[model samples]
Target: MPLEFEKPILELEKRIQELKETARTTGVDLEAEIRLLEERLARLKREIYGNLTPWQRVQLARAPGRPTTLDVLEKAFQDFLELHGDRAFADDPAIVGGLAYLEGQKVVVVGHQKGRDTKENLQRNFGMPHPEGYRKAMRLMDLADRFGYPFLSFIDTPGAYPGVSAEERGQAWVIAQSIQRMGRLRVPAVAVILGEGGSGGALAIGVANRVLILENAWYSVISPESCAAILWRDAKEAPKAAEALKLTAQDLLRFKVVDAIIPEPEGGAHKDPERAIQNIKEALLKTLEELKGLSPEALYQDRYRRFRALGVYQD
Candidate 1:
């Protein structure tokens, strides 16, 4: 389904398609009309996608059929050997981690995975990780450190699970531990925000030397709807809240929250997932190469400085 904001473009495209089909069947060249409509379609796309607001970008990040972590694992990496179970409890499908070969260099990859259909979403908890999920991520990071392999994390989650059962399992504590573990990792670490990087769930595996985000992805301490509900007592004010939050890639780039912004295919990653994944692959290879030159201590200090310099304050 096309998003509400995208309806105009889709409608225009449909009209252009209908015109072309009419010309094909009737043997009358609607060449001039089709050309004009095609030009208009191009401009319409540029206008809508180029000037997307934060809320629109958030919608794109959560767009149905947008590439997920599993998609990247299958396409971006080679010879993935998935590791399961947090060792203390059952495996959590929301968080996937394992060994993978990136351009022939071994690395540990971990990310939040959302299911494509209704059944998968129910199983993956809508990409919201539980306590065990965070634990599994930490274990993967530990493996990366032990083998002196670079750590690559993909962040795409709304937040950690907020259910009573999740809390009973120490959701907050495990997320904190995961954050601390990422902070202290001796191996080079890179994190990519593929889509909705929200709250502690995103941050748990997001503490890395280099943080990259997709052009339309968003990363924030809290989701806009939740922020709206907290401040205005209504979720309907989410657009206003999203504007205030500064979560979009452009906003974060200006704030230096992200190291680099990987451009997506025009319209969004879902429109051309293969190209989008290739762009991410190129960025990852470049970032990993840059980080590989530093020693373990240097890598740790680099990560420390990068995060420590996030916000501006004056007294």
Candidate 2:
């Protein structure tokens, strides 16, 4: 079912579909009717999406149909040879990475992978990475640095796994180390927030020379529900928390937390994934081109400077 705000658009679409079906069955000309309805649908989509609230955008980011890391990899890259395991503990399905070719340029691609259904979600731990996941990502980053392959990361995690077993495995230390290693990475790196970029789990792979975000994606220190619970003692206040957090891509762009905003399709990325992936491909190529000539020292310095410049200060 469509969200409350999207009901009108969906209803119009349903009517258009019905008219097309009737035309097919009865030989009556419904072209004029369908055309009018299509125009209305376009306008309605623009008007609704243009004025979406932060909370609404958050919902869209978490939409089940939104493209996942694997989805983007299949569409946007080629020859993905998936590498796994932390070489210490077991392999975590939440984070997937390996060597891939982007527009014929060999690069290391890593990202959080969320499952599409209940069983798969359980396997992915709802995209909450564990210690092994972070370690595996760090390993891939190191490999990319060693081979001089530009690192590309897609961040979409709720947070690091908070389960007892994950903590026992030193999840916090793994996350911290991943962040530290990323900070000093010798090769050019780019991270795109495809969906929910939450807390250290997201940041563990997010330190990049160029950080891009999808139009409806979010990057935040904490999830809105968690923040709401901490601030208002109730999770139902999440909408308010989302508004206050300034976590939307647009907000982060204005704050200079992100390098660029990759535009999504009319309703969202899920509506037109091919177009969304194409937009991401264009953005990544542009970023890689911009960073192509930089030396290793320059890459590190650029990344350091980018993160260092991420706060408000008054002269």
Candidate 3:
């Protein structure tokens, strides 16, 4: 169920609909009243959304209507040229990669995609990549390297596909190879966790010079549900597990897991997707500008240090 504040927003929408029907017969000046109610509802939502718990933020991040990779692609990139096939197997829809323009800057774009509807979700394997998907991503990484174009990746997935078919084709090997190849790629690369960044699936393309995460998005070594099931024998303990995971953007930055956190609008990126995209655009432009001048060898050394320095402890 949605929160209490959402009820008034729903009610106001219902009342507006009824008023519209009544207007056909009574010719009443309901527009003013409807607008006022809408404004009031908006204020109420802002109040409720102002202070959200970690769990509430998690809910917002996984909201079904949240924007996907394609949504952001259409918004922030132009002149896209999609490449196909892993040259080893069939094309995998779970991973999408191609060349595109980021504010007229030629760049290689890649991301995990989870479809919005049932059929599409099934087709996308619930955003879990198979061996072919990882291979395809590595192919694109090579393309980006050869051309000297900056690489941009979006991370969003539960995990890599764990089905028999995927494993039969060596899923683990492909994922590891992707990361291994990325570490040596001679280019300025940036990775953003736009949604769920689960396990090695997210890590496949996350090796980069600058890693950015959305304020509510999560990036974790293992998913909370997976950890709960293993530890407590109940997936319902995921909430508690999430508290221990420290996967949120701010937490990730504090742990030295990522370079930066991109703030979302009030509530989260879903509250206003355009605003979220704009914020991401600004961050990417800034990072690219900052890293563009570094030599390829310098970029590689920095990327290695960035990953090596994560989650250190000293006594």
Candidate 4:
């Protein structure tokens, strides 16, 4: 989907078409003038995308064409073998994890998968996992560790499913188990917040030796809207909550909540998804390489310190 700012650019292109039609109809020479107008339109698009506001960035991150978890798997992984089912109950499409090859090395890839359309959205629960989904992640993660394959998780959920079925299935317990298992996993693990990383749904897979986030991806304990609802009793106050939550990649990096921020294309990742995937692939390769050198003791020490060091008071 095109950004609202792109509407004017599209309108300009339409007008350029009208000019060409008028020139053709009247037998007038306007080719040179058309070229000039086209060049100006292209330059205007570049300028508009160069300095997008935070909210606009958010809109782009959730855009329909924005790269999904499966899209990244296709671009960044080779020989992916999808593993399904929690082994205890039904398979949840909201969380997908399996074996894949990254940079010629075997690895486990897991992520929250959102649907591309309305019917699929209902099927995937809009990327919000239930207890079984988290349970499945734990099973895959355990397999990765047992096989000595590094783990990579892409977080892009609004939150875990809060419906009665999810609660009945022990959603909180499953999420907590995932967090504990991920943190204690002996193999190297990296997490990237590809889009909205909200609440425990994100945190379950987020504990890692290295955490990367796209420039526009937001990670927060509670979503801005949720925070606004709790604090102000108005969802319309989300913008203010977003500002205070400091959930943007830049803010999280500055606060030492994540290891690094992956640069997205101007106008966010949806602008050019291949480039975005390339950035993530490069970051993941670099992090995996770095983690390979660390001993188990060092990995545990540093990972523990990384979490403990957050929220430190500095005067």
Clashing pairs in 3: none
- Tens-place lDDT per residue, model 4, 1-315, is 566866888788898999999999999999999999999998887887766655555666678867788889988999889999999998999999899999799999899999989898899999999988898899988898789888899998999998999988899999999999888877888999999898899999999989999888888899888899999999888878887887778878888888899998866788799999999999999999999888766777767877877796768
Root-mean-square deviation of candidate 2: 1.5
RMSD over all Cα atoms, model 1:
0.7
The clash numbers for all candidates, in the given order, read 0, 0, 0, 0
The candidate scoring highest on lDDT is: 1
Candidate 4 is scored at a TM of 0.91
The TM-score values for the models, in the order shown, are 0.99, 0.95, 0.88, 0.91
Candidate 3 regions with alpha-carbon error over 4 angstroms: 1-44
Deviation of model 1 at 102, angstroms: 0.6
Which one wins on TM-score? 1
The whole-model lDDT of each prediction reads 0.94, 0.93, 0.86, 0.87
Tens digits of per-residue lDDT, candidate 2, 1-315, equal: 477778898889889999999999999999998999899888898899999998888888988888999988998999989998999989999999998999899999899999888899999999999899999999999999899999999998999998999999999999999999999899999999999999989999999999999999999999999999999999999999999999999899999899899999988898888999999999999999999999999999999999998888899
List, residue by residue over 188-208, the lDDT tens digit for candidate 3: 999989989999999999999
Q: Whose TM-score is higher: candidate 3's or candidate 4's?
A: 4
Model 4: residues with Cα > 4 Å off, grouped in runs? 16-43
Model 4 score (lDDT): 0.87
Sort every candidate by lDDT, greatest first: 1, 2, 4, 3
Model 1, position 249, has a per-residue lDDT of 92
